[model samples]
Target: MRLFHSPASPYVRKVMVTAYERGVEDQIEILGSAAGPVKRDPEIVKHNSSGKVPCALLENDTPLFDSRVICAYLDSLAGREGTVYPQGADRFDVLTLEALGDAILDACLLCRYEAVLRPESLRWDDWYAGQMAKVDSGLDDLEGKWFERISGAFHAGSIAVVCALGYLDFRFSDKDWRSTHPKLAAWFAEVSERRSMKETLPKG
Candidate 1:
């Protein structure tokens, strides 16, 4: 299997973390790719229409796009039953949390691209502010509603959340989000120590 990835992509990191936790990291070969709204890698585009990182090609030549789909597929490949992704009612909760975490990353990435990719003259202040607002609201919700749920049992939701927080720390450290969400910060402190998280830390 081959995984299209960018070192600094939170989405790619999630997939890598998933592969690591599933004990199948060694089976996948990482292929660096440039993926962004304005810049696309043609090789990646061949596998994923969106030209995104974290796209995986299975051993049998099946292509998997999107971190969520790739992670779920990897879980199945590892014969992991109801672990990272639980079944029943717990599944929905985990999935919802994953969505929230992914959304946070979306906002953060958009804000980053706005500042770093777009020319100063073309950048829109309102757009950057809007994304930051989403980041703020998402962090607040996580701190208030999901802080107590964080556990040592690594799951898709928790993995996604940790990766999202990592991205913030990597790119928006000046925001001091940890100061406002101490519980989440503490939870992250522990989870970030996991071998998967540590090994997959974004390197820009």
Candidate 2:
């Protein structure tokens, strides 16, 4: 498989991490891309109309897209279905957890664009605050409700949470999220030592 990739994209990281966990990273060819909301990469558009990272083309030239789909595909490729993502009633719950993580990332990327990409004269404080509120709420929900899943299993949901928190540290290091989310912080510190997480640390 070939992947349109951006090192700085957390969604891309999600696919990469899943690939590593499935022992298929060696099989993927990384295609460099400069995907952006306004300035789309023409190369990526060939595979994904949205021009998004994590878009992939299989050996047979079949296209797959978005991090979630690609990660599931990787799980299948590894013959390890129902592992990172489970089967039955547990699947939807895990998918919901992944959605929560993605929502946090969505809000985070919006906040990042407002701060770095938007012009100073037009940046909205209200928007930034609202986005940060989502991040905070997400962290709180994970701490209160998903702590057991996060602390116990090595599933896709936990991977999403780790990548979300990793992005927070990568982009917003000055923000002291660990002070309140101590349990997550501790879990992250341990998980960071994993080969997959260390090798796939986000870079621009």
Candidate 3:
């Protein structure tokens, strides 16, 4: 399998981490692909219509896209049933959490694009604040409702949350999220020490 990856993308990190947890990291070959809203890599476009990084091309020439889909596919390939993703009703809960984590990342990435990608004169403070509000609300939901659900099992949901938090640390270090949600912060600290996360920590 070949993965088009960007070192700075949290989505890519999520897929890489999932691959590591599934014990399939060694099977994947990473191909550098830098893609952003304004900057699209043609190589990634050949595999993913959206021109997104973290797109995987299987040995059979099958293309997988989006971090969530790629992670699920990798999990299926591992054949480790009921591990990264649970079964039955529990699966829905984990998937919901993964959605929330991805939503948080979406908001954070949008805010980043607004601040850094857009020209200063064209950047809208209100738009940035709105995006950040989504992130804040997502964090509040995680801290208030999902705090006790973090089992340190390194499942898909937990991995997504960790990657989301790591993205904040990488891009919005000025914001002290730790003080606002100590429990979630502490949970992230513990999960982040896992070998999978440690090895896939985002860089650049």
Candidate 4:
């Protein structure tokens, strides 16, 4: 499997974290690609069609895209030991959390693109503020569910939250989100120690 990825993408980081946790990180090769708001990377479009990062190309060249799908496919590949995603009710729980976490990432990425990718004069403060509000609310919700969701070892939900938080650290440090969500901050501190997460920490 080859992963179309970029170091700065939280979605890509989620997939990489999952792959490492499954002990199949080496089975997947990381192929650099343009991601987030970039729209004209031909090689990315050639493999992913949608030109998105965090997409996995299987040996047969079938591409699995979007972080959730790639992570699920990787989980299937790992069989029983890849219990990060459970099969039944617990699976839905993780998926739900994954969706919430990805929503946060979406807002974060959108704000980043609007500020850096778009012309400054065209930047809409209201639109960016809306995205920030989503992130703030998302963090609040996570703080409420912190203990219930983080009691276990690393899972899809846990991994998603970690990636989301890490993205904030990388891109939205000025927001000082950790200062408000102390429980989440503490949880992240502990989870950050995991070898899988430590290895996949995002770069520019």
> Whose lDDT is greatest here?
2
Pairs of colliding residues, candidate 3: none
TM-score of 3: 0.96
lDDT of 3 at 199: 93
lDDT of 4 by residue, 97-127 (tens): 8888899998988999888999999999999
What candidate 1 gets wrong by more than 4 Å, as runs, is none
What is the per-residue lDDT of model 2 for residues 84-121, given as tens digits with 9 covering 90 to 100? 88886778878888899999999999999999999999
lDDT of 4 at 67: 90
89: Cα error in model 3, Å: 2.2
Q: List the residue pairs that clash in candidate 1.
A: none
CA lDDT of 149 in candidate 3?
62
Estimate every model's Cα lDDT from 0 to 1: 0.87, 0.89, 0.88, 0.84
lDDT, residue 109, candidate 1: 88
The weakest ten consecutive residues by lDDT in model 4 span 145-154
Show the lowest summed lDDT stretch of 10 residues, model 1. 145-154
Q: Please write out the lDDT profile of model 3 over residues 19-99, one tens digit for every residue.
A: 888898998898988787877898888778889887999877689988999999889989966468988666788888899
Per-candidate clashes, comma-separated? 0, 0, 0, 0
Error of 1 at 76 (Å): 0.9
